[model samples]
Target chain A: MSAFDIYIKSINDVLEELKNSGRRINVFNVPSSCSELPRTIPVNIGGNANPGIILRQDTYVELGNPEAGSSAIMISTNETGLINDGRITLIGPDIPESADKSLPFGQVILIGGASLDDKEHETLQQPGFVGDKIEGYMIRSLPQNIWSRISKDGAAKGFNFECLGKALIYLYKSENPKIESMEIIFITSAKDDVKLLDNISEQVRKISKEITKENWKIKGYDIDCELDCSSCGDKSVCDDIRDVLKSRKKKGLVK
Target chain B: MINIYSQLMSAANKSLFGLTLGPQNESDGPFIMGNGDFFIEIPVAFGCSFSDLTLTGAMGTGLPNAAELIDKGTEVGVESRLCNAIKVATYYLEAGLLKTPDMIITTNSCCDAMDTLGNLLNGYKPWAHIPRFNMHAPHSYDDASYEYMGKQLRQAVKFMEDVTGRKMDMDRLREVCIESNKQCQLLLEFQELKKAKPCPAEPDLAREGAEFKNWSKDRISPQVTEWLEILVKETEKQVKEKKGIEGVDEKIRFLWQDLAGSWASGTVLARLQKELGAVCVMDYVSFGTWTPVDLSSEEAMFTSFGKRFLLEDPMNRQALHTTDLFCNDILQIVKDFSCDAVILPAHIAHRDTNSRIKVVRDMCHEKGIPCLVLGIDIWDKRYMTPDVAFDRMKTFFEISGLL
Candidate 1:
């Protein structure tokens, strides 16, 4: 299976179990700044994408209108999470089978990040971003909050899940992925979460050995974790601790 | 003056023909008439010395009013006041307003002014070009920039030589520099004159020093040299006797920021200095000239570029960094000089970056020094003329009681 397709399958399995358990859940898809990486110039171009706005892109319509039997789940993406097309996709499932396909939805709202241009003389003269909001297919902005959050607890806090959630949103906004009574999955890039997948896989092994529940059975799969800092495989900013360690060793402070 | 006119009338003066001079007032007229081609308007720099004549081309039509010009165009528009100045110079040039100097040399101290003038001259004829040199604002004095500017001065000398068909004569240059130093010293003295309870010199003299750039002219020895020396002696005597100049008013002191005179209310600042009893003790241009110590290099071209470009780097860095070092230096000057307040007139184009304002305001605020931030343009006076701007400033000052 393709990499993103495998990701989709694994995440669906987790979501399916969560849905059957009757807990309300949300998934946001986001893109990594990798694709927009500049050919020249030392400055990173990816920070321009605001994370909060990306999470809210397709969820704007869902936030506006409410339905009787429909549960709302927002899928967001960032960095590696974006689809081939620039459009960020969102997928919402209707509670009833018939209402799923035919539900009328509001317009897809796209959220861009904070822009440097917005910090213009007049804009800076005011309190915030000059109340000059952007609503379009492709937008630009600085995700200040997201950068802070990622900086603090990025690797340990299941950030891969959040990153994948953002990507899922991107896919849905593009392909408009449909979810029915089938199982849901949660694919992630965290090593610890991948170990949790081992637990799920072990549980699936036991369930397969004996007779299990009737409705939602999670046939387990482990989350794949690939860490490549040089090429940027994930959306979080990894501390270049290796450099600090190497410097220490070189200085004879550490082995 | 009439004898010189009569003498010129007898001889065939061929210099005024091909120049298209213009837009200068009638009182400053006929100085640049010749037998060249077409004399468009008035020759504003006719009797001025050669180097002074060089900047005469700089005299262009001031925009009618800021509001009318801005109203006619979009938000981001290039107002061509500088272009009109160059064209005026060109009109006189073609009409032989000058003795027909071969090349044009332009300096960029007035931001868009010289840039526009240079481009207009180049566009008029491909060969007719002014090599662009930038003047550092007097206040910005970093060591590295000073060194760079020294090199730029050397290079500017070469440029001037090429344009004026004259070699860089060190003796002549030293003479010019000494003469120019006298003017700068006079200005410094004038600045010091403000210490008097009622200043001895008119505050408007400072404005004339800032705007007209009389120091930049050649032949500085004759008129200004003699006049300023005598004035300095007279003003010193008057000050010793505790006497004030007649027709002069007392003024307070303030810091000025983001006051580039274009498409904005320069009149506001002019008026504030007048009616509000406030003298701009610290300004971007006044503080920007922090010259370098080590500019002696063998390669004249590189040294010249380094000098001019580095000095100009502060203005260039305006887009990136929030607070300009030049502004910071002015703030330091404010603290040291015991100025009352810093008045910042940030207009639409310059308001986006809050670096300079942020630093100055925060520093001044923390120090408990009164700093006023005014949002207005320094050049375009469409919405308000000098009188109206002065009136508003007077009201503001009276209400604040800083006067």
Candidate 2:
């Protein structure tokens, strides 16, 4: 078999093992034709991802070469309205019906950066959303408990960054994923100025390279978004990216 | 009708009394204040805007000063006392205790603390807080922004009168000013006593003078002034005689990372000087002493006495930015004083420590001087005791030796 086939088979075997052990995993690709649909995956689904396989029981698998658990993988997706709540959308592969009945079906809510305004946050608290939809991929091969243990333990060893990078590659290397361009959006309440947007684009591009190791490139810069200046109009000022607007505008980024 | 001041005073007084009385005492009348022969303690609820804006403004506008506190320095004193005083004054005024004056006069010595306070008070009392400004140092001072501060104070006073039913009584206020100035002069005399070359009085005494002299100015007496005079004279005489702990490597000057003292911490620094052979010659307070105070009129004793009121209360730009410009100034002072080492004994475990460390690191790097940084609450021993942290400090000095 070719290298791509081997990678796909390896992931499928892990899903099978997870089903035998009694847990669930779901995974899906954004359909080629439905690119415009923002992901509507419900958060706090108790499982990592949806539309994927179910693990028959709890299981743990070591990731990365050093035989350390800290090098495990973590996957995240963009969930609709969860941006405010800070819960990214994720889903696992298909699961057996018997395994789903035995184990609780839920998304694993992240501890940090979750916002109350997000749908996942509401679902996690209330366990209900009017029209919940699940999308994206998941891995049942790794147990639910392993996500944090791997991240924290790896962080202690300075391998956390490396592990996270590797996890993203491992999850998306297969399934023939198409390239999606990352767009940097600059929104400000100040007068509409293209130069301001350019400065924001530069900053976003700079930070994007630092965090994603250039794997995520800025596709383009776009204007037409205007965020209300919390501080400019006798309101309490917020200390965020918007704070840099006045400085950046003077540098000729905003016109 | 029982006003908010009465209600708040009762609640706050109960809380304070409960704290002071310990656990066993019965809760009594939480009277905010009582009438005295010459004065009255009218309790009032201070608006939250002062703390919210001033603290935030200091943190933001004062970022430039972070380079200073992390550097080495000699003399240091905490001025949260001044900040607290302003806070109390604001609370009292908001609660209708202190009547809004026709003129809100102040000197220029305070940092962002006063500016923010003046603005916040004016915002709260629009009509009563009108403008009648005073410049602490009309000329020969840096930070020209201070020139406009008097205008802000005047505005605050006018706005205050508009809010409260009190009219400005110029004659009565002039009398109050005279009394207050005399009291402040007496307090200054006591403070001067702490400046003996060898410091005849204990460091703790000097610290108490620093902390409470302005606070208890309203309760001044002949006895208090006399006692202060005697103390100052005695301290001077003792310093001439070299009565205090003397003699260390003259080069062994230490810059405090911040003022590491409660009432108790001052005593500890004094002990460190004696035991560790180091002198603390400059600090945030040294810069603070240069702040302009009220100079409204000669007989405006209230102007003199209330100078502390006009000065930044509880907090000052210098106090907040000890880690900012003061750290760098301190390092230069250390070099000028020919100091040996720098030590930062901040409560590093506290939530505010990361910012403190960042400032300190900037100073150390700028001067290329080694620093001994440790974390421990100077007042409380429960968090991380000084003893446990002292060895780490010693180890740093061991590595770097004397600067």
Candidate 3:
């Protein structure tokens, strides 16, 4: 057993308890094996992607919509055992089932490979690794979070969690050769489930952040500020300018 | 990060460019961006010189009525395709916003935009009678090239003094040159300070330091050098304390080549900082690693001045010179500062830089550095909105895996 076995087991245990509690759960096995997964970069992006914006009028369904509340859980483990090679589990209504509804989204991707390590974690989880390859999916945020839009055209072409699961499976496995097994869970059932996923994600987000830090550290970087520095960053004027700023700040110039 | 940095910026803001900006008729300084050791000899460099194009560009474009000012420039048969900053400057002279100078020294350190603009400034009805000396710069660099430009420097001194009736003081000029060398050394030290891990300086600091460089042109006043000294001391303290910009995380360090012309509404760095931990570590204006002047003799001083004019000056060295200098400048900064990416703000008017950007991108690719070529006018926001720039940059960071 590798380091991620416990994590995979915990995820399974949670899902099993949810399933036993009468939550609508559907399990699917990808039609193709990992080796035969068709690889594709989204035709819409064409390598040089502008911010993919699926407008409100053109939208089929929004997942993890910032307004609807969103949480994402991503973890990769070297323990290839206890891994369902091509399984996608969906909770609540499917993508096609919801015509124009916003869902409190929970997306969890679990990867297991015998050779997987920390360094490859970033590449394996790059937005392109998921968003770029999935034909109908457009992610609107950075990694570790997903505020995504599925197009009406994509839904017309029979896009749903089953196909999304298969698309992402093909996307990830085809792009990364070391990956031996992968599993994904999409929960659009309730805000409570999304929050639960956020709670469960603490351990994985910490690990992903460390991977990011390690990679940047090798290139001689230290992430500097964690606060709202952009507000103070631009207003860094001095002398008479600073004096004016001080006066304005006292008079409620800026929050 | 430093306490005195604002003071330095304040001093820089008051350089030769601003001397005539507001309703100031008593000011004597006339220095602009160009002129090295010979810079002060131009009669205008008697006190202040302004550097950073970003600060000047920001001030020009952000003027609440800048678009109207630009429209006014176009009204006078000036082409709108010309750099917006140059157009604004043209409008300033035409509208009497800038007072007619006693004498104006026009050297084309930038490109062809200056050629037409120079003609306008030189022939403007009110200032046409004044002693207007068009300083000549050579295309190549060599010993004879230095001597060739050096001779012209002497002519400019004679021209300015002959008109102003002030004798050229050799000893005082020498003293100013020596002091100028000290300020340059301190600036070089400040450049080294920026390369620290976590980048002790923020992106705007480089933008601010670009203007501070011009403040050093006030050779007679030791105050500019003192400001530089405070900059170095404060920056050194920041480094020793492992300090960085108050609110920057610096996850990504990028070199902003050709950020010299203007700030793109000052949005790129802040957005990049807030969205990603990307901080602009260095830019073309802030990157000055020049060979100091010999300062031994007055003649050599002119020669060194000529060398620096073509070889060492901020925009002139890279923008006016060969494609090799341009590529080498980008690659050198990338390595020296350990930058992961390069943002070439392919401002529309930079025909010189825009033509060579392909070569630059290819070279960056060879070195495993991602280069983003953004096609926008650095001086004008209407050409490409700040939001569009943000989208492109964010996408670049994502696709390049910097995110």
Residue runs of model 3 more than 4 Å from their true location after superposition: A1-255, B1-11, B14-20, B23-38, B41-59, B213-220
Summarize candidate 2's per-residue lDDT along B1-403 as a digit string, tens digits.
5532233324332432332222211222111110110111111111101112222221221223322321211012223322322333344334443323333433343343354355544555543435433333322111232334334434444544554445545454444444434544443333333333343344334333333223232123243344445545555555546554334433245556454433224344544556665556443332222112333552322232232233333234333322323343454445433346667665432323333454455446655877766665443443455555555555565677652
Worst 10 residues of 2 chain B by lDDT: B34-43
Q: Model 3, B106-133: lDDT tens per residue?
A: 6655567666666776677876577767
Least accurate stretch of 10 residues (summed lDDT) in model 3 chain B?
B48-57
Clashing pairs for model 3 are A224-B249, A225-B248, A225-B249
* Per-candidate interface DockQ score: 0.01, 0.01, 0.01
Candidate 2 error regions (>4 Å): A1-255, B1-144, B159-164, B168-199, B217-227, B245-253, B261-314, B319-324, B328-339, B348-370, B394-403
Docking class of 3: incorrect
lDDT of 3 at B279: 81
The predicted structure with the larger lDDT, 1 or 3, is: 3
> What does candidate 1's lDDT look like per residue over A87-202, in tens digits?
33223332122211213221112222222121121112211121112111112111100111121122222223234234323332322222110112332212222233343343
Kindly list the interface RMSD, in angstroms, of each predicted candidate in the order they appear: 26.3, 29.3, 22.0
**lDDT digits (tens) for residues B1-403 of candidate 1:** 3432233222211222112133222232122211111111001112222232323533222334424333332222335332333344444444444443333334433234444444444454433443433333233323345456555555545655554454654544444444544554454454444344454544444433423223222224445555455545555665556664353354566656543444322455445545555655545443322111112333433343343344433343332222333333444556433467666665434533332455456557765667666554343444345565456556656666766
TM-score of each: 0.42, 0.36, 0.57
Question: Residue B360: error of model 3 in Å?
Answer: 1.0
